[model samples]
Target: MPLVRIDVIEHRRTSEQLRELADAVQDVMLETFAAPARDRYQIITEHRPGRIIAEDTGLGYTRSEDVVVVQILQQGRDEAQKRAVYRALAERLRERTGLDPQDLIVAVSANTRADWSFGEGQAQFLEGRL
Candidate 1:
């Protein structure tokens, strides 16, 4: 399972647009990571202006107030697949929500399958219940 956390500046996007952005990210995961539809898990948080700061890392790209920070936590995947996911997410989100690629920041964290407990306080993957 992949748990996605999206952080953005408050009032930058409507609720509907945020939903679309989440859907776009999930779609990329489904296509590139082989994630099932039932694996969709996401959290969206809106922060006040200046609370979330992002720099261009010397890329000379200026970030706007509409910046979106997406963090995905899941099991390990190949680097190629991860890169593909990033590209797909940027493309799809841009197309669906008109979000600039420069404004999107994505990060992924890997953990063991045993780290997840879907329900019943059980580690589903480790117990072969996933």
Candidate 2:
């Protein structure tokens, strides 16, 4: 399962818009990342203006106030899968939310099954409950 964290500037999107954004990302996770059905886990945080500073890292692209930063933490996805998720997220978010591809930054990290615990003070994945 991928735990997604979407960060955006405060007041930049309406409540409906935020829901659409999350749905778009979840679609990519399910389709491209191959996450299990009903396995959605997302956290959306709205930061005050100027709170998020994402430079292009010399990529020669400009970011607007509508920039979105998506961080995915999961296990067992290879580079090709991760790349597909990035592309799918860009396309889906652009089509669904009017977010510029340039304004979107995606980062993925990996962990082991022991790293997760859905609840009950148990590592469900490690315990074979997942």
The estimated TM-scores of all candidates read: 0.96, 0.98
Q: Which 10-residue window in model 2 sums to the lowest lDDT?
A: 121-130
Taking the tens digit of each residue's C-alpha lDDT, what string does model 2 give over 18-82?
A: 99999999999999989999999999999999999999999999999999999999999999998
Which tens-of-lDDT digit does each residue in 37-113 have in candidate 1?
A: 78899999999999998999999878999999999897878899889989998899889999899999999889998
**Each candidate's lDDT (Cα)?**
0.90, 0.94
Residue runs of model 2 more than 4 Å from their true location after superposition: none
Per-residue error for 126 in candidate 2, Å, reads 1.6
Model 2 earns a TM-score of 0.98
Measured by lDDT, the strongest candidate is: 2
